[model samples]
Target: MSESIGPVLRVIGCAEADLPAGPARQVAELEAAVWPGSSPGHDPALTPRTMLLVDGAGTVAAALSLLYKPVPLAGRTYRAAGLSSVVARPELRGRGLGGRLVAAARAELAADPAVDLALFSCDRPLAAFYEAAGFEVLPGTVLVGGTPEEPLATDHPGFDKVVLAAFFTDGPGRDRAAFTGVRVPLHPGDTDRLW
Candidate 1:
């Protein structure tokens, strides 16, 4: 459960496994509509959680996934969480529901003592949306996903992506600058190729 963010909209969350049947189905349908055959949004190995934004009628308005895992950046490993698979119902796209969900998730991560930072990548065009939700674009930083053996990077040809992040705690040796302009070896593995 979450505090009401609007008169008619509230944010609720659960571990991916704990999501109730109704919202689960809505989330599945929404994912299929947006990403025809993409992998599941929550990677169990990453301790994933799902956040749903719902109207007062108890209908899903928007949804997103959060994955917590150790992320390596600039030679140090930090506890991190990444936002993934964000989608607002087609009819509700222009009303800022997705932005609300993302901001709520950012707040949740910031409040967690275990999370050192939040990191994720979005298409170049959507960078501003994520920025409006309180994430700072890390210019020229590449997020490398997949395993080191078969990595995928934001900087790869034909992929216009930008890394966005919010540091909740000081990183190794209390150095935040270590993350700037460097490649983050996120490597959430094959299932989430670029989470």
Candidate 2:
């Protein structure tokens, strides 16, 4: 790994209301590129709140939107954090920018009093990438999202997602067994196709 770049990590905004007009366009552009065939302002889970990793020259090296929803499972609800549109400038892929951004997001989750855990889905080939970035792949585990009337699973055909997760709010999360070998109900809603 190159000497970890001392990029500036800042909270750009959390909701549409939080985004300053100046950076919102850049965020949306990055989102469209990272998550193709999707438009901005579609999912309620993807509140406009975003985080940025600015390189030393002040360019938006990487960006991602934060998603939050109360994940209910096994008679309990955990405040969960989800990540979307995580991307680094195409020219800057192997320099550790993406990993740095993810690490920072994890720190944000851990520091929040309400966020009990963080989870996201990635393609099978990207599982090792996330693992290198500190996310653990939950084998045989599935995240049930979408509407309660028509739930969607990460394992659904055509998606073949691998669930990556980390826990923070202590208590039950301290026990890995609680999350292993089970299907977790995430229910992020229909608009959040990647959740």
**Which candidate tops lDDT?**
1
Q: Lowest summed lDDT over 10 consecutive residues: which window, candidate 1? A: 170-179
Q: Write the per-residue lDDT of candidate 1 for residues 1-195, one digit (tens) a residue.
A: 576989899999999999888899889999998999865556689888999999887799999999988876556678989999999999889998999999999999998999999999989999999999999988778888988999999999999999998999854335457777888888998888887
Compute the lDDT for candidate 1: 0.88
Per-prediction TM-score, please?
Answer: 0.94, 0.84
Reference-based lDDT, residue 189, model 2: 74
List the candidate 1 regions with Cα displacement exceeding 4 Å: 170-175
Q: How well is each residue in 79-142 modelled by candidate 2, as lDDT tens digits? A: 7888877878787789887887777777777778978888888889888877876778877888
**Models, CA RMSD each:** 1.7, 3.7
After superposition of all CA atoms, the RMSD between model 1 and the true structure is 1.7
Q: How many clashes would you count in candidate 1?
A: 0
